[model samples]
Target: MPGAVLAPTSAPGYPAHVRIHEVGPRDGLQNEPATLPPDVKAEFIHRLAAAGLTTIEATSFVHPRWVPQLADAEQVFPLVRDLTGVRLPVLVPNERGLERALAHGAREVAVFASATESFARANLNRTVDESLTMFTPVVARSLDAGVPVRGYLSMCFGDPWEGDVPVTQVVRVARRLSDLGCAELSLGDTIGVATPGRVAELLNALAAAGIPADRLAVHFHDTYGQALANTLTALRHGVTTVDASAGGLGGCPYAKSATGNLATEDLLWMLNGLGISTGVDLERLVATSLWLARRLGRPSPSRTVRALSHQEPRE
Candidate 1:
């Protein structure tokens, strides 16, 4: 969104490829006020796959009681489960959530952990240690069943109740989750207060703690308009995986100040400029977001989506 509306330009210090873990169907939709039907939700997943997003977080099996917006996880998962070359990972809160996703043919699952104790109690209703303990068996069992487990460490950069989370505190929880057998860990800036320097510091601390860049992903929110900047810093630190939401839809249900995630289209525009290979079609992705926006009765919050939507097509 910061770049000019022109052809993608190549840059140095970036890899030839970056993996975008699209979270619109799960993290994005879960925070929305509308309760979309399962069939429509399934179509959204299919459209994202068609747009070339290989890893799409389909839905959460965290029970209908907690997140009524994604209440139809059982119905939504099956609609696009067989999409070829696409991996759909569902969010599993505990062992029961894992089984529910497994029953729906989930090949990958993610467990949520909080870097700070305050957020841990707020989001998971457990302390930092207690949440990790709850996730230990979930990660173990998922691995035993040949399903890769991803660890989502929220409030990595900042938290609402706990001001300015220490880098050391994040690394401590991150190390424990990684040790618990999480194949990948997504660091979340839950309140969108992360700046470029802070993002670099956290990545550096994690590396110092023995967490390789390859096993780490960054999930950023755009509340302060720093998502792209923070993400660029992570990229320079060799973080290859990024979590984004289509149409800029998502917010923390626990943290009221938290806003939408890094828009998938906005991230793609920057990555494409850097000559990174995501295998995602930007036009298709923008179109997908537009389609979803119409259903939600609002315009997409993504700057790229809005710009490209109104741009003149070339001959």
Candidate 2:
């Protein structure tokens, strides 16, 4: 119940435009125990684009041994890369992953590391420094090829193994990523343990570290149902980009007690109600989430989709 207060109505020099990056195809589906066929993932990407999501994380190019569900990344990447009016970014763990992504016509790639030392070792099987070092060549190669690289800093909040993460550590990791030429850095509340105050404090620290708000994005999970409130905190601190998943279909495999991500449907609803324009079709988006949930053999986890579907249709 912390941060129950609404975010401030205004902050000095907050960006006018907000961007929502769709991560359902990659982060959402990848952690699911069941494997979704490449074609299904491709179709889901297509539908998300049709619903007006311009930026979507299509798949990860990691070795199949690590994420078996995304083993068909090679096939899925090519299918979504050519989708008109959408940027499909693939996650790359190292240079080898980047090479595979580039082979599939990847124009943008993401390199991820964790903020908490324990989570870094558990998730990437490397220490914080080691994980960043492993992706140095990957970032250099992407820069050489003129491909945009986004850095993901996971466990920005508390970690399962290492309880509350230090803001100083988060700041250090994020500063390193920015110094590495990552076009943008995403701060992830990997297990959704953030309070609005914590989110605000983190953003303030990053700003103090000389990382501009324009180069920052937030990825929040809804494990404790605080994602939306935490998001408002990010907005107050001038974070203009967010990462959300359709139907709330994602949870981190490495982080126990984590729940689905901040749902795209839920995010859209809140944004629209706040008079923030996202250029998305809400009804179409709801239908799409329902369709995907059915395909995955589970009910949609998007509370907004469920409520809106039952209410009197909006004009």
Candidate 3:
């Protein structure tokens, strides 16, 4: 069941254009215990570009001690720096992170804030307001430097420390980020506790807060195997962009038992089956996933990839 081929596409109400922002390089590998070489990271990005993923979150510019896996970000970014038609965005925790990212010639930057108070405190070591205050300068600096910034709002579904995050809180943080000059705000189901109903409710509130669905992206983890379902719900609500990991290699360090982000191969498989124009190559994506999986010494978590690779031979 983990690697089953999806059924064929049918006519649906979904949009024809959906943007998939590949997160395997940064979010997917940050939590991994073993350190991968800079060249390996570059090869992974190369394969991703080959797969037709137009936008990729290349790395995070956090302190080396906090995430040693991404310590080589400064070193790794310049290797793939000249990729045309692909936006390589890096995550920045503060002004210092932004400075480092700009030094590496990053044209886009992403800053993260959480909806749940507990998660905000644990992930950023500060309160929600404090995190926003910290990002204000980062956002302003990026804007001043002509860099586009994307905001990530985590824990929209539920929190490990606090269950069932309030919709009001989600809206508040999203609005604050939007007000802080973030070009886009991605709502994250960090713990994968969201259902379709909760997603609709949260989107409704965000809409009321003057944050359009077009400026929104959905980041769902497949912990409960509901990442695809949640993504479909967001698409129905007019969300055009999504954040997924290649080969399903992602997890939040702040949440216990949190699975990785939705796999890129799996998402592309689903989108291809739905006849949606994601402009992604499923076969190349699967190959890249396999390569990364071998480097990590773990089997790929993408069900579709596993299925396609293990298809039975017809005699």
Give Cα-based local distance difference scores for all models: 0.91, 0.87, 0.89
- Writing each residue's lDDT as its tens digit, candidate 1 over 1-315 gives 233536767768777799999999999999999889999899999989988999999999997888999989989988999999999999999999999999989999999999998888888899998888899899999999999999999998888997999999999999999899999999999999999999988888889999989999999999899999998899889999999999899998989999999999999988887778899988888888988988898888999888888753221
What would the TM-score be for candidate 1 when compared with the true structure?
0.96
User: Global CA lDDT of candidate 2, please?
Assistant: 0.87
* lDDT for position 101 in model 3: 93
What are the runs in model 3 whose C-alpha is more than 4 Å off?
1-10, 311-315
Error of 2 at 114 (Å): 0.8
In order of appearance, the predictions have TM-scores of 0.96, 0.93, 0.95
lDDT of prediction 3: 0.89
Best by TM-score: 1
| Candidate 2: residue pairs that collide | none
**Per-residue accuracy of model 3 over 1-315 as CA lDDT, tens digit each:** 335446757648898889999999999999887789999999899889988999999999999988888999989999998999999999999999999999989999999999978988998999999999999999999999999999999999889888889999899889999999999999999988888888999998889888889999999998888999989999999999999999898898778768889998878777777878888877778878877877899888888778776643111
In candidate 2, what are the lDDT values of residues 1-315, reduced to their tens digit? Answer: 121214434334445557899999999998887898889899899988988999999999999998899999988877778788888899999989999889879999999899888988888989999999998899999999999999999999898888999999999999999889999999999888999999999989888899978899999999888999998888877888999999888898888778999999888777765657677777777778887877888878888777766633322
Give the number of the best model, judged by lDDT: 1
**Candidate 1, pairs of clashing residues:** none
Rank the candidate models, highest TM-score first: 1, 3, 2
Report the lDDT of model 3 for residue 48: 93
Count of steric clashes across candidates, in order: 0, 0, 3
Model 1 lowest lDDT segment of ten: 1-10
